[model samples]
Target: MHRPTPRPLAIAIVAGLLQLPAQAALYAVDPGPYPPAPASGFPAWYQDSHGRTLDLCLTKAVSSRVAGAPGAPAYMCTLLPTPGVFDDTQPIVFPTNFPDEAFWFTADAAIVDAARGINLSFGTAIEAAFAAEEPKAGDQVSFARVRIRVDVPVAGTYTVTHPYGVEVFDVPAGGRRAINMTRDIGIAGAGDFSGALKGDVGPFLRSVNGPYTEGNERFIGDPNLDEPVTGSPFNTNFVRIEGPNGIDLRTTVFSVSGKLSEVNRPTPLIPQRSTYSRHTENGNLRAQQDVFVMAPPAPATVTLSSQTPALALGEANGTGSWYAQSVLNPALPLTLQVTADNSLAIATSTPTTTPMPLTDLVVISRAEYSLGSGQLTLVASSSDETSPPALTARTGNGTLIGNLSGNGAVKALTTGLSPIPPATVQVSSSNGGSDSEPVVLVP
Candidate 1:
């Protein structure tokens, strides 16, 4: 029986602010002065115990409205999810260069050989931690050793901190995702992109936007920037993820940005909210940027049904099954939930419905596929009572396995990625609710 979903009245992971939505299209903010971290090839940070470390040293004060004033000339950075996730607010903040080495990080335990040739793939399931706006250098910020599951091969990208770090884990035969869960990233700070930002900030961001976007960090590579999450308009823009050894990654970023203005469709998100800024007093940190934190007023009787905030990729091994649309009732204003895990909730959003009344609340839940550096034979299936359900499958951003039929499935293969085993393979459904199951090839 279809159970009518009720309004969820729970605090998000941060317990300070509510997330927007996990999968909402994020705006192109600053990747905090980083040209995409290496997308593929060897990882930038890794560890022996299935975990990786990222050491960001704060040398100078990160800008806060120039003179700590609103609308001041400052290049500010806020932690946001890559791959268009915006709901996460209280991201995890690790001391990359903390005074000691005892810090620990319970990292997302999934890795993939995105390319067959030891190509690393980072997991976007991890959210970002908006650290205090401050300097970058001298002050050591260490991503505590993130532990990967010892059994699965940690071979892809994983979110160590605000940036992406490559990790590798041991995988037994038939093992796909093996990352340790209790290690930390320990490194010193080193980067000179600040020198590049001297003359023009736009060029610097543009140059690095590809790496950021490809790394699933925030960058304005989205061609579908104009559309809402569910609307088809989100597909209009082209934000491609390129690896470090990505042959076309650099070029593609340039091509898209060159014509971004001409596209004439992409616009800034939260137009009313200027880039965020903060004014810190002795004890209070006031927001210099006037942020209207209220959600866009919804009209309908929208409510959330259920959510799976946290998921272990290993549990998704093989063809597992989960659905997010069971809470959707055709009558009440549609309020559906897929994940309730706080860690993965980095990209969750509050719900608001104004115009659309609930006729059929359905979501193409958790539909995604990633190919490592090898022969990836992908298969996707769906089951629902809907007659002759519409299904679609396309690959880009994250591999989009479109709508599925009523009890339908789709499959495909590719060697286009780097030659490594997949850390994890994600699957999702579009219409009549949704489901995602990892295709653990090795396991």
Candidate 2:
């Protein structure tokens, strides 16, 4: 079984602490398919089985066109600190984590910032127009998704990246097949690249998303061998990072001149926690981050507190309807007291109830019993309002059960019949729900 990472539990020292409203979404939609082609370069970064582009951190909007070099027209986005800015005048570098590989798309960008709480009007307009005609695999779906979250003071604004997966693969500019690298020597191999490239791998470079390694770093050539080489991570090429906040990065083209380059980063109060790969094109060195503005390590003291709010069950679709409602108060774990709201509309007495047993095959006069047979029996019936009880007897396999009258007290003689070998009795309600109840036939 594929198990998910277990989360830690928090203890509450105080009983009543201020609790935030529910933050997780109860329902979600698929982000859609993966980019068809690998970006201009970066073959090693292929779309995983799920169809998302490897360097999917940055996806191009429908309006954008793919250019061979930097400074073309494309939509670059990122997940930055809340209230992040997108200036048409400033040079904003959207950091794709593979800093060493050349970014596939290079163009002018206009960001609709989520951290700043900007509504996705621009993207929505494009989607509305295209909604009249949906986009299939080959066609482009201009409907760019905006990752959104609410802002709480202590939590800031939670950030998520929406990977747009429609038509950004092999057209004139997209790729058809995924290219694989580093099978034998592996992702980072030994005895590759040499001399000045190793000093600061900025040479021997090529495309984005593909795999390569540089510098004097060591790699596993075989199952047992591990050796070093002096070369550029890639062959001396450059890539650009474009986004509003995806990368907490500040540098555009990090040099992979073998020696570590200063890939400027944001001064995040919360630190980063992940390892980087030496894989690159030009034997160059650059920096990277897996997730954007991840929350700080869980607080040492996590306090879960809340006041029990009023909760009620909504309408029932049917008996088969899976009814569930969680009144998740950070504080109380109370057992729910469930009862019928307007029970008068429902039947007062159970349609079919199993009663106590009598002799093995024979049923008693006054007692009710579902003796593994398909009928309920009245043990006895009361007479008139002012008269004594009158009785009747039933026998054999074919018999019907009747309701009590007058005082509705069933004393005797309403007994029903049972088969030679009684079979199980299944009761079906008018509401379509069914259950088995006891029945018996007596001599």
Candidate 3:
């Protein structure tokens, strides 16, 4: 059964005070600055382990209030608001020689090709569809590492608002203050994206808004922005830096993806092969995301039900803002209704009444046909193969040649045609994943 969205609790707030979420702890050491050093470049870029690229560069800040203010040198970056498109908060600009690496948002520390490393240095704009991998057997977990250091023109208390939560720090005049928030989201422990209010600022994750509709459901190019753990109007990702006087710079919300896991790592206590799937099924009261325990040999016939404050899985994964899966998919506001034989742990997210397509949720690696045997094979894979996408094949003329409800990864169907038809083969998924390759004659 679907769990209902939690209603906002009644609370009072004292104006002009920084509010941290209830029970949220401070990061011991923040993830430091991006670029990490000096560099020469205009528009720069960094690609994560999964090949997801974040482009950063210098652009002139624009603000009507700062008339004749020589628009401070600000940052123009890509990743948030959507991948490929450049957006900036036009924060007060940096000094002319401000090291490119020391800019506002730098891309750093990522898991690539199953190995961990950092992709430093900005590059030219590279356009690519946004994609993220679910944490399963053999795949390394990924996450966003962030730290904020603000050079105060005139120091006071600066309130920092981001996708996860809010942070207020004090900096002396002309002193640089670094908010060590590197531990916001991690495999172990909780992030600061959700929870109760300590002051006026708490969960800063966006809810519902014009153009930013669907809250945090998968946006067209960004499938990882679906924050179903919190449910309706899924919140997108962003960071707002506000300081004394009238200093306010807010980034355009963007989308990214990551997951939690326990392989060689001792913490987070996740099963080795745990994974998840996000979908919008009929009758769902809110956004729907479900988890699974990929227990080797075959996919189990396990069921999931939404539960308030989650269940044992939540306790097992530790606590805080980090969800069971990607902040995009999330793992709060829901849990698994496990069977007695179910030893694997799982969690859930808020349900979505609306459905959206998640890119690469099902990826088709190869589709080919053997002319000699007239045998056609479609090889595809999803994060969760237990509930794989429906596979369909057709001719160029739209002739339905083969179809199968995907069971595992490879689906094969022999045309059995005595004389193989001279046409193309196309494969598609019920979840909007697809591939088309010309009919290549192969022995």
Could you arrange the candidates by TM-score from highest to lowest?
3, 1, 2
The C-alpha stretches of model 3 lying farther than 4 A from their native spots are: 1-144, 175-181, 184-236, 253-443
Clashes of 3: 27
Best by lDDT: 3
In order of listing, the candidates' clash counts read 102, 76, 27
Note each model's CA RMSD in angstroms. 24.5, 29.7, 23.4
- Model 1 residue 194 CA deviation in Å: 20
Q: What is candidate 1's lDDT per residue for 179-221, written digit by digit as tens?
A: 2233212222243112211111111112223212222233222
**lDDT, each prediction:** 0.23, 0.21, 0.32
Regions more than 4 Å wrong, model 1: 1-139, 145-182, 186-333, 336-383, 386-389, 395-428, 432-443
Candidate 3, residues 1-443, lDDT tens digits: the string is: 00011211112121124444333221111222322222121213322111112223233322221233232221122223212222233332222223212221222111111111111111111111111211112221112233344444565676766534466766545332233232222212122211111121111121222112122222112122322222101132445566666766655433322111111111111122223455444744223343433110111122222334433222122122222333234332222343211122112211111122233344546556677787666565554344455678777777787785445745655555436754666676665556666665666
Cα error, residue 396 of model 3, in Å, equals: 70
Which candidate model has the greater lDDT, 1 or 2?
1
TM-score of each: 0.21, 0.14, 0.23
Per-residue accuracy of model 2 over 108-208 as CA lDDT, tens digit each: 11223344432211010001001112212222211111111111112111222111111111112111111101000011111111111111111112123
